[model samples]
Target: MIAHPNGTISTEVSDFLLNCLVRSSSWNFWLSLFLSFLFLLAMGANGVLLVTIWLEVSLHEPMYYLLSILSLLDIVVCLTVIPKVLAIFWFDFKSISFYACFLQMYIMNCFLAMESCTFMVMAYDRYVAICHPLRYPSVITDQFVAKAAVFILARNGILTVPIPILSSRLHYCGKNVIENCICASMSVSKLSCDDITINRLYQFAV
Candidate 1:
């Protein structure tokens, strides 16, 4: 439910209309084509990398584990954002359901943070391998990678879960048009009929 300062609570949130350029414009047509090409390229590259990492026994090491995690994160991000963007651009279908928008927000936030954490872990793995070669075998083992996986999930899940929760509690009784191709947190929050300073600060701190 959305609470308003005037002692009114509403459960009638409307679907958010995503903003895109005029579908008839030649520029938009070219732009959409370009975006589609990039999306396909990215997906193909990441999918191949992920499959290779999964099937190759020689690549079953700590560094490759982190690499595969990065690939999965990339795939998740692409799948979450590209399809909706293409829908908006190609078919002029821009409305996104309320709960689905929040779900997208959560996935974007969580996976993005996970990618950064995975990169950090990868860096540490390389550091241990290069600086402490003899100890690398014992220090960065399969168990260490497993623990790092848990750490990434736990840390990002705790930090990112509140973004949608806090965003949903705000009153959005007016202007449901989201001035972006995707359900970006800022685009959605800006339409709420309430103060969003807390949301902004919390997202920035995260």
Candidate 2:
């Protein structure tokens, strides 16, 4: 239902997309199955990495601590997303509920932002370690890393909270099918028969 810039409204496109997905042949199923299996396997490997990090006392330095955080984030992220995606491939319930869809988007966005921020902070640490070797120990302390992690999480949490809350309040009429693999904000807004200028603007801002 997105209102085009030309003052035209987008027709409900979910049914058409759903039909196409439904009609996907055996090859599509196999491809999806293989990919989902690979994703799950990757998650398992990350879990092993996490366990190894925990068991090794020598891996308690700032860099390994960051790696552990990364492992934890990877585990959480895959846990959040991969299961549902795999279910869609195996189960019959392909459609995600509106609230669930938005929630997924919100969580996914929060994690993505946090990951970006964490990597950026890690890069800053590396820069300090390389470019200013003398002050690196004083500058990138454990407290600083903890603070940076907290800041990253808090910033993303604050910025992403409004998305689900605001998008959930928007009118959707009868359109409920999502075309993409996941129910993203853009796709959901596109289902509306109302003006989605605000949604698009917010999406761009995010």
Candidate 3:
């Protein structure tokens, strides 16, 4: 581990092995199979929903657009974390490259935040539609959706970038086992050899 001038640490670990649940138990096989089925079901359902919205012009409204965004976010979050988890559980392939781990961490944090923002905007849409029915049309337009999309992207996209970057800068001497299905920010940071006060505080604030 090397200390930096900015009071951060850096490590040179090539990869990490995830400490998946039930690694040696007989139930691992059945759990992996069930998770695989759920993964496929989620992907298929989200894909069909997106395609249906695209094809049907009647459903081409702002609400459907937000739902589509939410679906897309869910698909991404699932894809980001599940395949590797299944590989770990089924084939014992738990080695994730250092950079890949950080990438996964970034995607999980950013997309989840974006999903939350989408829900908040959806709530606002419902409020306008129910509480102020007449002005809803003028208030919520295509332009408003476009702006909200931009806000979601810009807000969460920028805010979550630091998580992976900070984690990458930490020094890891030997402990490279992540005790979770996904490369969560706190889980990964706990393996660092340096102080993670900032990481913990930032995660809490987020």
Candidate 4:
């Protein structure tokens, strides 16, 4: 039970309603449809890129491996976020269960950082090829790409696991309305009755 301002108590929160981006007007609903179409397009393109890279042995170098990794990240991000956004806007299926919300929080946090690191490595790959062309083949090998992939996963997973855990440990106190389309750390933490400054600081530090 959770205490209220007037000496009352309420049951614990079990689920959260995902809010639409624009609930104030019905006319803006079409924008959600448009954005949903764009997400679908992006996912399709990335899917094709991944398939092509996997099928073509000639594209098995560091550059294409890094590109495929970025494509994989895009697909994951779209899969995690776009479907729920579409559901909220089209079908009004806004209620996300408590555990599911936190799970989404973890995946979103982890994969986004991985995607950024992948991009950074990709830029470095290009830098090596253009500036240090003589040593490019030695420095940016298939094994180097593999190690980078492992590092991205390990680093991001270790760092971001704490985000959802820390947020979930807070006292939600029966508040269940999430003010964002996605289960972002800040949005979820703000629903808690306890202090969330630590969450904010950790998120910023990461």
Q: Who wins the TM-score comparison?
A: 4
lDDT of 1 by residue, 13-116 (tens): 66889886464668677888998999999999998988998899999988888888898899999999989988888787889998999999999999999999
Candidate 1 backbone collisions, by pair: none
Model 1 ranges off by over 4 Å: 1-12, 21-24
RMSD in order of candidates:
2.7, 4.6, 3.4, 1.8
Q: Model 4 TM-score?
A: 0.93
Q: Mark the 10 consecutive residues where model 4 has the least summed lDDT.
A: 20-29
lDDT of each: 0.88, 0.73, 0.90, 0.89
Per-residue CA lDDT of candidate 2, range 1-206, in tens? 66757786655333212212545657568866786787878788888888888899887667777777777777777777777666666664566665677778898878887878878888988999899999988998888878887888789999988877777776675556677666667877777666788877877798
Q: Rank order by TM-score, top first?
A: 4, 3, 1, 2
Cα misplacement distance, residue 101 of candidate 3 (Å): 0.1
lDDT of 4 by residue, 105-144 (tens): 9999999999999999999999999999999989999899
Q: Tell me each candidate's TM-score.
A: 0.90, 0.84, 0.92, 0.93
The candidate with the higher TM-score, 2 or 3, is: 3
Sorted on lDDT, best first, the list reads 3, 4, 1, 2
Model 2: CA > 4 A from native: 1-23
Tell how far residue 68 is off in model 1, in angstroms. 0.7
Candidate 3 per-residue lDDT, tens place, 43-114, comes to 999999999999999998898999999999999999998899888887789899999999999999999999
